[model samples]
Target chain A: MREPRFHEVEGRSLAYWGLAALLAAIVAAGLTAAYFMEHIGHIITGMTNQIVWGVPHVVAVFLIVSASGVLNVASIASVFGKAPYKLLARLSALLAIALLIGGLSILVLDLGHPDRLIVAMTHYNFTSIFAWNIFLYLGFIAVSAAYLLVMMERRLNSYSRPVGMVAFLWRLVLTTGTGSIFGFLVSREAYDEAILAPLFVAMSFSFGLAIFIIVLMAAYRWTQRPLGGAILERLRNLLGVFAAGVLYFLLVYHVTKLYEAKHRGFEYFILGTGGIYTLLFWIGAIFLGGMVPIFLFYLARYRHSRAAIGAGALAIILGGLALIYDTIIGAQAYPLTIFPGMQVSSSFYDGVVNAYTPSLPECALGLGGVALTLLIVVSAVRLFRILPENLADIAFDLDPHEIGATPNRGALWAPADGR
Target chain B: MTRRKAKRELDAGRRRFLGMAAIASFALAPGVRLIGSAQSSSPASARANSKVRWGLLIDTNKCSETCQACVSACASYNGWKNEGRPTDPQWIRKVAIRDSETGLARTLPVLCQHCAEPACVEVCPTGASFRRADGIVLVDRHICIGCRYCMMACPFKARSFVHQNLTDQRPQAPRGIGTVEGCTMCVPRIDAGKVPACVEACAREGRGAMTFGDLNDRNSAIRRNIAAYSTTRFRADLDLDPSVQYQGL
Candidate 1:
């Protein structure tokens, strides 16, 4: 068995500069949009009293959830001791950190008084889950950074497993905290379910791995690095499993709500006649995000096809967004049941479906967050020895037992399982 | 003779000590009052007492669906109006409700419940949404980051976020863009030793459907009415202990 050599990306190419510049421009545009929304007020955006959180939040929440999930790749390598996954560990940590920063940027910038962020930082509201999540998100970034250091530095190599274990537990709690943002709300019927926490965890795994596959494939192909089919197959299969887990949770969530008389209206709104919400749930979340990816991964003929694998991963990402959109906005659109047996109407838009259309600036801001994530990842790979020099099957064809002892500070790496 | 003399001396010292303590209390009274007044303030009403729970009772039976006097009064006093948009802040609104089963209809004014335990107060990431000692829920404009979690958490749809900047905001009511605002229960008027604008207007119209009083005071008009009538709190199933109660709904 030989140790895999790691090196920094040569980012001097024209295409590299072009991509970075494009991302930078989008980030700038997003900042500009935020400035107008802040000083000019939220009226400039599509956000109103009814739909307070719009496209920016949908994008932000998606990134934050996926950020926690992206670290699973490193957790698999270091905590579970999966040798094949080890090659992707550094990039995983980098991507996780990048994605979180991107998501957090959107959330902060979208605030009504983004300037008063200092107040949020200083104030202590221990009871609020949103307050707790501030620390959780920050702690994850800190922990993932430490995990990356332990894996990269031979001087701290032995601590990787312990740190990885901490990160793994932290991410699970982080996702739970994220889900509880909605789950804890007694007012909204769509969010009050206990299953939302685990559902988010499942979603993270699927969404996280889907993006990882896309990034890994793109980075390897572009860098002229050999990403082995063996690892790809393993990751794709895992994605299928995670997607199925999400599906199972969704089913339980709906069935349990259906059993309760109080939740029947919400369930019907999302599943039956709730227009876009129902379409997103069925076609976007269930069919595209769930069934399509799962089927693509499991089918015998498409098993080895790179195009199928990539498409399946892309489908999962798109579907994950749709699911999140359905979860966040769809629930909000359903009018709140203020009166149990009464049909209420008021000047306040009460007892009626709230209308929301995403403004362009909001769309730009949302896209900016995604671009920022890619920009950070793109920039980091060039600056640090985050990517392995090779991931060919021949390089990783080693015994599982020999993999954990991987080489020193930015020097040695290995793929553990070939048996 | 010696034991009796010692007991007399101790009693004399105890009397002297009590006199000094009383003098110290008198000296510290002004200082204590200054500190108390500096810590918090009531803009609309005189000092809110912990013993007082300002509440409202609305008799839906007497409320006319055609008359929006209370809503108009609230809007005028709070410096908020329809502005021809759904996004406009409604400090108070008239909701027309119809029973789906019985085909019975009722109209009532809906505003911040000023709940004893408010969902908005519980979920505000910053302690911006708060309940005062007198059970009046208020939003601190400086602390509210406009996350709108309070709006989402509020079961009554009581709170509203300011969608746009305003040039002519009332000097009295708290105002900020990217911040949440709701019914302050006319704290300024209460401070001025007056009823809320809506209550005053309702009374002026001779409808007298709305009553604002201290629910804690057993002898108060609101408490006496509650004692005599069958009343309902909106979404009582959640057990929020709302200060506002409706009769004959």
Candidate 2:
């Protein structure tokens, strides 16, 4: 394809400002919630000594993991030399940066002392996995930014392949580090599995692309740029494969845990006896997040339905959040085995499931991170020539549905008027 | 007196066995004397090197579930209160453990293990969680960012995050908002030539079930007791080499 043209969206419309204003309000509320946490303390939240890391952690991990995974499109284009993904590369790199910033913001703000961020930067605990993550996250952001620059600077275009290769390798390590954050925890039953590293990589692929498709379609539709059905089809198919990868990893992880005599109680607690956790694992992560999305992506009945595809992406995000919560909080709820082959009871809530009802401030703080991510993405796309001018030529030629169809012109994300 | 009761009688006065000269040469050199002098005189006092490794031995047979003097003593000494809520900080707490199959139950007071190779110290993003030369795991509040990753790493569930702002912190245990705090093994008291508050309470008011001494000194009361009896560390399979060992499971 002759060098495709790109341009900034005309963002002065009421829809654009209204959306920005709404997100800004949410961000403000989230900040207020963070202030309450820092000002008052984590006591206001549902987290306790038992369930130490709470809902905010779930959101932050989701965004951070997805940020690393979102680079796949750019990697496919530059690293793997795929022409179709090349057109989407710029947006992919931009989204990765925005998502990372958003995730990192929540992580820092929710700290016991967000003020001591400088200390985290200055002090180096070489042995700590968490400390290693600080470097990994910063490196991923820096490398991805340079990759974007190489792709944008026509003179530096040749460097995109090498830079993209570095980014791809860095992303793998970044996701592994993220997974190992939980995996290295020898204490907890649910988080100790070595498979969590690859599981998170698969999760990142599914969650990142799901969010990418939603954002891509929204940006194109709102700007009245024709998004070809071909790209969406390819994305949905890839999303299916990625989702299956996550499911496969999870199955292997669960089966192996079940095989262990020591881990049986924890497995049963999550799969059966644990109330909210069990519900989240079965209904949210397994059915909606894992199964429904896969079916929506592949089934012929919903194949051409843009709304179905959008819903599939949304489900993956929600389900991924559920999985994060179940894995983190659920394992914590089960008491640590202080004595082997013994049941322990304590005022510290031992041998019994710890209850956690996430408070408003924790939810608000988490939501603020989401708003911040969207706001960053929207503002960046508006300020820069990230989106292609039109995918009409590519779509009209390859996508049978887009060949003769007339869209309603004012629709958001799809031709959903009568669908 | 019964052998167990006779041991209880010796528990309180065992520190006096080390001749003052021996005490001055051994205990005071690496621990109490230098740490005490550091607090009273200047910050430049000699560092407590690895010559000493403080440890505790608790006899579960004497630690009754109904008595919470050790817990109360720790709270009173540290100026923290257990509000009975899940979020409350329990520097040291009582646990009632029973065998799953045999249904044989026992009571024990669980606190910081002060592991020789602490998981908390290993995972802290900042080097806030640290082990002193004398084998005490501590959180340096000034450096702790409160990520609580250490809590996740600790096998014993021995650490607690200060969930709320505090207005009632004692000088000996200076805690504040947002930092992770746990049983310090009464570092201040240890430096001042005193046994930990919990151990003292267990000796004075309760069952005299606890013994504190330098583990490196084979002649020390704790090491002698462990050598004479079958004692085990919690989660010994992980091989963390916790300073705290227990007897009579």
For each candidate, the alpha-carbon lDDT, in order, equals 0.87, 0.87
lDDT of each residue in A188-253, candidate 2, tens digit only:
788778999999999999999999998987887677777766677778889889988888998999
- Give lDDT for model 1: 0.87
Model 1, residue pairs in steric clash: A4-A413, A83-A416, B44-B187, B44-B188, B44-B191, B45-B187, B45-B190, B45-B191, B46-B191
**Predicted model 1 interface RMSD:** 1.0
Residue range with the least summed lDDT across 10 consecutive positions in model 1 chain A: A405-414
Q: Which stretches of candidate 1 lie over 4 Å from their true place?
A: A398-419, B1-46
Q: Can you write out model 1's per-residue Cα lDDT over B18-102, one digit (the tens) per residue? A: 9999999999999999888866564433477789999999999989998899988888888887875867888888899999989
Per prediction, fnat is 0.80, 0.92
